[model samples]
Target: MPNVVEPKLIAGNANQPLASAITRRMSIHRGVHIDLVDARVERFNDGEIFVEVFENVRGEDMFIIQSTSNPANDNLMELLIMADALRRSSASRVTAVIPYFGYARQDRRTKPRTPITAKLVANMLVESGISRVLTMDLHAAQIQGFFDIPVDNLYASPIFALDIREKFKDRMDEIMVVSPDVGGVARARELAKRINAPLSIVDKRREKPGEVAEMTVIGEVKDKICVMIDDMCDTAGTLCKAAELLLDYGAKEVHAYVTHGVLSGPAVERISNSVLKNLVITDTIAAPEPVKGCEQIRILPTAPLFAQAILNIWNGTSVSSLFETSTMEPIYEGVFRS
Candidate 1:
């Protein structure tokens, strides 16, 4: 084989628990041992970010696990700075594992004079000496093109499929996947196919960002257990509205599987009062106290998936297999994107 550097995991202030979990998962593998870098990523008195990596990273393979979630600017800066620090420390290679890539929704120019902030962030990362990127469930699939370095875009579908199979195994006959809006039809469609469930679309018009003017159910959800799917949840206005619409249309029960729970503003309150029976989200974005306390919301783990991906990256093996949900007869087929 070829040479491979000792891989190290570096945690930023973005999400410490996730970084630790990723490290812990990888440690259980036989013949492999990866530990968190002995580093300090802190804020200075003037609110400036400072990074100090105590360990000698010379020629070491590095992976920085940071989610550019809330406090978006701060988290983004921390990632950039950390990558720069690792690069200066002479790390052989640096990969940023950003679970929730912020500014992703701003991928394109929505209007005249508008900035493509996603591309700008990508440019910043490239300039920061980041050699690779691994992120999950980007708001816009095309955003991957913004990066000059190799990008590995992972999905939560496989994990979601397993949970759905277990939760509604007995009610598969009535399961129906509903996209919160027209844009998320593809995601919901894949999940629907995975579970062999019917698909529905919520036809809604957005007058402005975070404000839904109207909502209409586009398919038969009557008496069916509706499961809504989306990439992220910010204010929960559209989600709440769609759930109410489904309930009004005679659906049996409404559930949601959102990847990034950017539950800002009254999102928690809205979910609490909405007709959604349950809201299942991933740990891509760390859940706050209110969100953690919400009875209707549940958080899932993405560490094992990411750990395997990291190992594949380090070993120069195929990472795509980790995405194969129930793709062939060792299980089911077409459950996850091939």
Candidate 2:
């Protein structure tokens, strides 16, 4: 909290509770003369999005909190409009604090005639007057290059590591950390090293979207408790399929730790019906109703980590130290259903 400038924070409709939580950790409260420029969004009969911000924001350091989650286009548009409004109102600077940056997976052209949607989103933000962006665990680390402005890509690993230590204390040898896809091996490997466990990979091939066939396992997983780790879980296709495959490969139990829970389409039903014992996701995006009701799924808040990061940035302190390997003893054993 050193040299704090008391930057003005604003919230959008995407995930107000998360915004409020982050604010509380930063010692800012609601209704403390905070101005909310009304984002009057209306949908036309044709299902189009319209947005208007109704407050004058002259010379303020504006931080707009909006996550590009479900209805990705609408939420994205809302953030853009809010930035435009603040820009025209003479706001000194505008920072878009999007915890769950949507369209991040489309970081590059995997096939012919495919658009790099992540770059497009970055361009849109820049065009809409966003001076900077603060987000976490992007689908691809290289996506940061898409933005010309300063983009702070925070890590939820510290938060996830803390929870893991508390949940799996001893019997670490019985556990194996898994990356559901080859692209995520680094992420899973890091978590595995932190927990003093072996790393495993699910070598799967996708024939098309939302369909995966697990071909092989890359590590020793027989009769061991497995924990799959990923940046996000959207349709639950990859995670669920990996879990089932792990079980078939003699994994005693399977759990997954994903940062963003986009839980779109039949994701909830898929996870519920899969072989997963538990699915832990961070509150980057507000989880939908069916996802919340799923018995095997649990949500942990990331407000503390983000709040601390904000404080560090405001005070010109280093946040890289937060990712240091944990020295604490482990906490849970065996796979947990919740």
Candidate 3:
């Protein structure tokens, strides 16, 4: 609110809808309508990425919103290039606002020989001259340590908890939050605590990629409405399999609330045909047309959360306050349910 350096928002082609929504929320927070920076991002005939910042960004604080989803490499390259352009143009600071950090699943090596792509990506951003990084619900929390610069890893539990409260307020007692895999129990427990529901875990085994060997319900889900929570849902195999196991265990209904819906491969089709009643996801990654067409899939906007974080960062205030579930109301209720 005080007279200070105004931050300019520049969007990459990764997720324009989310970027636009963030800017709108930023406008309301600043009490004045703010516009996105004018920029052009195109590719040459040989598939070389090109970027041009038309307006002057010298001495300005710049926030580039880009999600490394779907075409992960291209989007990542665009972000790096944009940062390079802004830094070369004399921007005071560049903050890379990434909603869905791709390659995060490979934060560590599972086998004897494998690359830590998450750290590599972090190194790339830092080398590109980015002063800070802002991301949400990283696949692995430890990935924050991969970056030497300051990194803000925003959580989606508060947002998902609000939605769960509104949708199942009357059935809170009948609801049981579930973790599709042991790795996600912590995330699921956070939402369970917020909704005041019991927690359940799906003790599952994964033999290899895109496959679920076995899933056993670890808690009492019989006849209860089960809500599965995870950081990301890719291919939907694990979620769909877990839903089936829950139903088989007598769950009245099974739903999912995931942060990043990296619904690649047969995810859309699988969710549409799975036993899960509904699959609620955040707009961290842009949903494709087929995914949008699925009746069981729903997308929630995360702009308000990101916008608030950006505002706090610019004001030199604490960002952890944004993670407090009671700090904000359910502003995006019933907006993008499909």
Candidate 4:
């Protein structure tokens, strides 16, 4: 707080609701009220993005809150253009606070003639004059290495664990943290360690082309309240399929905790009909009407988590402490049934 100019926040059209929520949390955080930077983000008749800054941001700290969710390309462009404008306006430092980083799933090439889109995105953000980057639960952690600038990648496991503790207090011993597939074992293990629960893996494989993927639970999930963890849930095909498989294997109930709910295609419909109890997703990507109306889905606010991280970053405190603390209570609404 000692720096001459207070940090300024702005939003991209990708997720204005999330940006507004962060601003609200920042207002009362630590007895300090930070205002959103006055700006205009618009689109031209030809689909070209335009950004206009109304404030004199000379030597001021800037943070652009955007989630590169659906319409990833356009939202990504908005972030780049805003950073360029701030740099041209002489902002002291600019940090791109991306709640959901798109193109992260393609961190590596899976087949011949493929691209590492995640690294490409990292380079794009850096070239946009962003001095630093802050994001939550990237699809791949290794993507951080692609950025030459400082990248603060946060984890939602702590907050998720907080909700899990209270929700399953009675069935703590019967809880089993499950990784939907082999790729997410680490994420599942982290949550398992947090709540002192056993860990399990769902091994899925396809025997041939155009065939249903056969799944096998690697550990004892029979009679356990299976809690699956993953970074993102897109389409919901694999996630829902795994949930049904768990129930078929004799699990008492199944629940999921995913950071970014990209819920594209028939994801909402599938979750509504799936055997899972409920899907708890963060407010990273703005949810659409179908997603909101789905009774089987719930939302968890991540504003406090990001607000604390930003405050600590501005004050030059330990940002990692936010992840390590088990007792930090976040502001919440219990209606989501976390």
Q: Largest lDDT belongs to which candidate?
A: 3
lDDT of 4 by residue, 1-338 (tens): 68455568988899888788887887876556776788999999999999999989998878999999889999999999999999999999999999999999889987799999989988989988998999999888898898999999999898788788878888899999999989899988988998999999999886652234688889988999999999999989889999999998899999999999999988898999999998999989999999999999988888888887887888888888877635355344352353
Q: Identify the leading candidate in terms of TM-score.
A: 3
Across residues 1-338, which tens digit of lDDT does each residue of candidate 2 receive? 68434666677779988887777766742224333445566667997666666665677667888899987888898888878878887988898889999999899899999999999999999999999888989999999899999888877665666667667766666888999889999998888777788889999887887777446788888999998999998789888878888988999999999999988888899988988999999989987778789999999887766666665655557766555644111211222223
Tell me how far the alpha carbon of residue 283 in candidate 3 is from the true structure, in angstroms, after superposition.
0.6
Reference-based lDDT, each prediction: 0.89, 0.80, 0.90, 0.88
lDDT of 1 at 18: 93
By lDDT, is 2 or 3 better?
Answer: 3
Clashing residue pairs found in predicted model 2: 167-332, 168-331, 168-332, 169-330, 169-331, 169-332
lDDT score for residue 66 of model 3: 99
TM-score, cand. 4 vs. native: 0.95
Off by over 4 Å in 2: 1-5, 28-56, 325-338
TM-score of each: 0.94, 0.88, 0.96, 0.95
lDDT of 3 by residue, 8-33 (tens): 99999999999999989889778887
Clashes of each: 0, 6, 0, 0
Per-residue CA lDDT of model 1 for 143-213, tens digit only, reads: 99998899999988878888888777788898989998888988988887777888999999979987788
RMSD of each: 3.5, 4.2, 1.9, 2.3
Candidate 2 lDDT at 173 equals: 67
Candidate 2: lDDT of 288?
72
